[model samples]
Target: MTDLVLRPMTPQDLGDVLALQAKGYPAALHDSAEAFLSRMALAPTLNLVAHDGGGLRGYLVSHPWAAGSPPPVDSVLPTAAPQDCWYVHDLSVAEAARGLGLARRLLIAGRDAAQALGLTRSELIAVEGAAPFWRRQGWSLPAIIAPELAAKAAGYGSSAVFMACEDIAAL
Candidate 1:
């Protein structure tokens, strides 16, 4: 693999991101390309893309939790103040990009961005058999998941595990 370049997601990159998401999580429903593009534009910095010379290889999308919002368990809700928590909505690496550590790099980038913005914690929903992978990356399953999120994740035939890391340094 050539040197991987990481950059903020652009509107033009929506198709590629959605395609990768479909491929990476065939069993899970995802945001439409339009929705992804809109969110990316609104929070470009939090929507990161990693690319090799070939094309987009991986990406991670995150958003801060709403003020006074209970811990995220289902869909993310917008917050008024810059919440101390950052939620990792999605992270996917192309099949060809696997084993290259692109996912880890993207994750670290997200964590760094969150920390740079003064977020004290980072969280994500681990789907399918990804629990072990998140654990290896220093994320631990929390005691409970939000009820709303649990039902939403069930549609994907998997329960969402709440995982958290103390700081970007932990990545």
Candidate 2:
């Protein structure tokens, strides 16, 4: 593994972030620029990117959100919503950067942010058959979301699963 730097995402990094997103995920799962900007604005505390000798290698986007619910895909969120769980909106590692534990590092960073917010759990919608990766990171699909949230999760894909985890190292 090479030395890497993990820091907050910046406006200048959006181009690389979008490109990496396109390469890291399938077309159907790609997020719009507006959505990215909105997440950055509403949840700047948790949007992070990893830089190595080659440049951006991975990124993680998360936000404080309500449990049993997930914001609809490609949609902006209100700043006034009550938040009880740290929601992980996106996580990506470049193909060339895999095997370096970049994803896990980003996750741990997100987890730390969640813990900092005094939240006990973290949640995310797993798409592109990436549930196993998330599960390996200590997340679980308890089917804990409501019908409305479930419907929103479906927009990511037919097989998207809403997962949550209480293991962010504080426990």
lDDT of 1 by residue, 34-110 (tens): 55654454456788999888999988887665422333223333334355677677889998889988888888788
Clashing pairs in 1: 66-79, 74-149
On residues 1-171, what C-alpha lDDT tens digit does candidate 2 reach at each position? 457999888888999999999887888888877778777776676889999888999999888888877888777777676678888999999998899888988988878877877878888899989899888888888855678878888989998988888766642
Model 1 segments more than 4 A misplaced: 67-82, 144-156
Relative to the true structure, how large is the alpha-carbon lDDT of every model? 0.71, 0.84
**How big is the positional error of residue 16 in model 1, measured in Å on the Cα after superposition?**
0.9
